[model samples]
Target chain A: MGAEREPERGAERVVVGDKRKLRLATASLAGCFGCHMSLLDIDERLFELVERVDFDRSPLTDIKHCGACDIGLIEGGICNAENVHVLREFRSHCKVLIAVGACAVNGGLPAQRNHLDLGQCLQEIYLTAPDIVGGKIPNDPELPLPLDKVHPIHEIVRIDYFIPGCPPSGDAIWKFLTDLLDGRTPRLGHPLLHFD
Target chain B: MTQPSILLDGLPVPFVDGQTIMDAAMAADIFIPHLCHHPEFKPQGSCKLCTVKANGRYVSACTLPARDGMEVENNSPDLNDKRRTLLQMLFVEGNHFCPSCEKSGNCMLQALAYELEMLSPHFDQFYPNRAVDASHPEVLLDFNRCILCELCVRASRDVDRKSVFSLSGRGIDKHLIVNAESGRLADTDFSWADKAAHVCPVGVILKKRSGFAVPIGKRRYDVEPIGMQVERLAARSADEES
Candidate 1:
């Protein structure tokens, strides 16, 4: 090895002379769309971001399938079979993968059900909870099978970075993205590192 | 008699006759990073967050009495790494749910994690089935967030003289329980004015209807790191004694 540094796995080198824009994708699994809302909170700065980045397989683009991309931000936990499939596919498509928000990082609010029996939880909601008449648990092959427990994305696939907030502030996301673009190790310190 | 001292992270820290390593460290405005070793209460050394190497042996700094020439490694990388693991273990052991928690920014456990730069929970969450005791009209005891530090137990017994709280069961099954036969907070004499009512380092014991009185970003730990805040408090106490 000479003076040159090898790029880390999932970290694509952005050469100064390269003219191609970076491809970015995002996916939501078992979470509220709050993380994406925070991403949109980037607001007008997103217009400036598109000048250097391209969106693929994201709610922003309304694309159902993820294509090969430079970075992928996955929100929410793995709570169902579909989430697992989507996460694995997303991981394969992106060079860099980030677990965004508390859900992606540590299974957030959805994980409150982790201690409960999934079957019992379903039963309580549909059959027993309150005023209910002839409630039945839906069992359709078209519906995604729910997992026994909600798990953070890293428990299922490798995650390059973690933004640890319920929904990380848009400014924090912007700082992390700009740091990555500038070839610096992304660090969320002080106010930005909040979990809530 | 000459005051004994310990070399804490290569820095000389003086201690009086009966003060522990934590006492000396706090007196010197040095942070040892602890959860259960509150200055107001007697040190329990239960959490083990303040584990430090004293003369080549690991000991809880909060409980161990300082000796002259004792070389302690407090902030070593290995120790901090261990501390990070401890923080992660604590996070996964409980249903922290910081976003939904009223104690988010004011919580000591969350603040300590941020101070230690804990990025993820790092292990599969245990997420043990727990309950919230909202029977008390003035207080709420969410058993989900307890780290089993027993600060509340000590505070209730020693300070408030209520003995309203105790840890029951054993091993993985160990849990906090109320003193009343009915097993509810409302059945006990725990008032909002009690020391035990306010000693929780996490979000377990909370005031009813007082959630989110302070905005998210404006709370105690959000403004600055825990180390700075603890040190400032220590310095303020030292100034008061003089």
Candidate 2:
């Protein structure tokens, strides 16, 4: 918490003594969680990453919401009102927002339903499916209402960076993060930019 | 007479007098990203991914013929940004669920998008509802994935000589239609072994009952990027000709 202050003029001199770790927040909106799993695929490097960055509010720390942070890594598409809210919150709170994986970047598999009528989709899933014993399209006031169509996060918010893949490879993620931390624009080329 | 040469990104590429910029580049083992220009068929500059700047003017490499001293610019940031936008339009225009599609790895459209490093669709999803034609006994025509490159149309007319496929409609409504009164592949003389069936660059024309036989990671573009394959093939052809 002590390290979360906004830098004042000439704060660079004071920061040499403070030694604040950069804060990172992450969230999954409407994806399969494959991207988050791929992040963990960084494996042993997680130890090194933890030393350089702190989890401000993320699934890694099971934090409910984000605080003022240096970076935000968002996975998944915007499928409902709740996603829109969380995305806007991240934009306001974080200085840099990175849309990670195919879903976050291009609506991925979930956007396949974009061609189908939302009402018919809900009816098929919730009421007409063979496995359902007694099901209804749950319209609880607490639940988020579905958007007419799924959308990539960038269509709704300003995303500073994108890592594209069904689940972007661990190496790509590592390179992007380390490059960002080292003050370089991440360029995905050759083997790094795979779609399947 | 000696062959005329064009400068592609400052590299000299020799071309036959009548060859398009794309054909000359391919013969030189250079890759200009494209979807509609298959070697087996006539060039159709439908997919403009192979757009390159020639002497400060942008033109589709697939259709534009090469001329002596022509200076072509490819693989640049400005051109790639435009290519990325074109790829994005294709993505959102159709429901391209790469993770679930049978042609996930082998699809040229997906591979080109990857090569361009198109991070996001960068546009709203159109999600145009399209139908799948599983009526054919040995082939599946999933219209959802068609990029309208006209490869199948050209292959059927020129190679198979069956005239089994044709494009119908205009603009957003344009689609691949079977060449039959009933408008179904089953009603036509189309077969799985036809050149038209094999010429589809995307998942639109998939062989029935042959899904995922090669496994995910070992698929065509998965093993090597599409550009590398084109370059390798070009090199092999050049070697054979010499």
Candidate 3:
């Protein structure tokens, strides 16, 4: 895909090998991955997307860790230490970092726990539930420790752009990417900015 | 008699003598972003989202009366940046978790943030621990989502003639207080029929048992933005005039 000649600049159709496919990295921190699904909802446009960009560390490519990349699209809020580390890594590796979806931008649903004690919350879900036989809040060293409150990605690192929605609509994502690729600042307006 | 005019973003907007800049803009199908100014109620100018440059000076459009030949800038980059900062402050000052909120799709605050392209909350989340008042049998008051627009305060006092709601405290500590001696909605005579019950633009004053009935994607602001309806109304009036 990288070897393919870039799209002709204008009507002259000049071959430019200097323009390589932009590398993109994506990650799901504490979200449901609905934004990733929305990206896929671009449907046949995914073909066009692949022609213009390559995935580095993303669920699509199954790449474990991000290397140097031009763009990083992060979905979800920071709910644990692992999210903070992953976010920091993305910030260091990517030239442009985007907070995609409500979770990444504003802590969304997971932040409902911000009002309650984290330990009490775990107790209700694990130890105190009536249906549980021997349920316990996992204290395994492998598990990441939960933060006191859910935090949006911007609160932890610099986000160059944001795509707002529970999961931003396919059209909104498409417009944003195309605008960015075309070297235009993406602006979400009527019909594209629905919160649901 | 010809209606008076105000130059909003350089476009002439015709309005009655008593109408503010916001009212004139709405009358002309131009949306001036606002939260505290409702057409059916007196303008409060508290939220300040509708602030615009009038004659090169900033003024709340909701309260500033329109005058003939007055120039107002509503959509400039500088004004929008200011509005965005104010919105960010509102977001961090309250617990506005839109995904889990029953008012998620319908919330004016969420819709305004989306309309303004607010990239993020852009500040540390205060995560204020406010309590919910479920004492009223038919209404629920969740203090977490209040932006202090005071729509309910005005509605209860002016429209319902009940005076059941009022703003208390000051600055960051300020909040909505029930009028009853017990400081509970149940202690007050706030009912389903009260104007206050329907005035809140956020999830603060929700009618019990009617939540999620319209579904997530089908709510009022979900289908169209908060100001679109007013714009449509303006368009209809324009059509009538033409």
Candidate 4:
């Protein structure tokens, strides 16, 4: 999809090449792939997205980091130190960064663990799980290091837009995406978001 | 025509079909655990403590609205275990110190915990580092005791339309927030009449100059366990909804 071309209602529209180039990439940080899946849940329209936007650096379309994209859609929370780096890069590289799910936006169910100490949980999970063992504990090297506290993206980096919910309803994501494609900042007009 | 008996823990107890489970328990003298429910004010079943496995599935006793065939087991080993775990989570999330708390002796949460035979929280502490805001001159903030049931926030938002209270953060970091610029509640437009003070189930939010005013022996929650009270209220409410 080109940055300058707009879609023509109901049907997905395509603006060829750099004529309307709207660079886009997606990254999944520290969350279940649920939010990413929701993006595709837009159904056949997502295939239309392929015709319109530059598909880069998404696990769905590409396997690289977004070097410099117009929009970076992030899914997950800023749990530890590595999350800070990812967020910073996205903020600097992408013209817009959207916190994509309950986890990324407000630190959802995983944040429930925030009630307890981090060391306590690591001990319980690694040492106390019936099947887990000292060496058997899986730790991803690429994973952002675990922090004592899990934080929402806004806590670490300024997010241009937030799409909250365990993964906001699919239609809501679509609405936001369309607005961004049309070249205007989209707002989540819900009162709850404004109460704070 | 019936101050009828409903089977509770195998014995026939007085059954008032329209009252809440908590209220029926109170009338029949049985106990059901609960919080965020009050007699003077309306019952807002946000706390989810009064949840019970009635007939097979989990249902909040206060909000479920009882039925005639409802076979309630207030002290069943299985149901009590769930209550224990839920109560433990509430304790860990914010802060609820029984000792040194104004609501300690008469608190609904404390009473339910005692009824469930809880000696102490088996889990680790969640000390969230929240501050106490005693700004209104009438109310106080005890960050440790909030369970985020959202009853107070709801009451303020829906009934009063005050927009003075809200819940910010989410999951475990979720805590009650005051509507102010600095995130300081005392700086807002809340007042004694807001009664946001009375809605808290734990000591997290307390009213100043109102503590212990009812005398130890006269306190309502201290006199009976919450489970029984929920049983009674559930029966009445079910009839209303149906």
lDDT of 1: 0.88
Angstrom error of the Cα, residue A141, model 2: value is: 2.5
Off by over 4 Å in 4: A1-196, B1-6, B11-20, B26-29, B39-46, B209-242
Residue-level lDDT of model 1, residues A1-196, one tens digit each, is 4335465422444552266889999999998989999999999999878877899999999999999999999999999999999999999999999999999999988887787899998999899988978999989999999999999999999999998887899999998998997789999889889898
What is the DockQ for all candidates, taken in turn?
0.64, 0.60, 0.61, 0.03
Model 1 alpha-carbon miss at residue B83, Å: 0.5
lDDT of 2 at A1: 44
lDDT of 2: 0.85
lDDT of 1 by residue, B9-52 (tens): 89989988888999899889888899987887788898999999
Alpha-carbon TM-score of each model against the true structure: 0.88, 0.90, 0.89, 0.46
Residue range B65-90, candidate 3, lDDT tens digits: 88898999999899989999999999
Question: CA lDDT of B122 in candidate 3?
Answer: 82
Clashing pairs in 1: none
User: Which candidate should be chosen as best, given TM-score against the real structure?
Assistant: 2
List each model's interface RMSD.
1.0, 1.7, 1.8, 16.2
Which one wins on lDDT? 1
> Model 2, B92: alpha-carbon shift in Å?
1.3
How big is the positional error of residue B56 in model 2, measured in Å on the Cα after superposition?
2.7
The list of candidate 1 runs beyond 4 A from truth reads A1-20, A115-140, B1-4, B231-242
The candidates, ranked best first by lDDT, are 1, 2, 3, 4
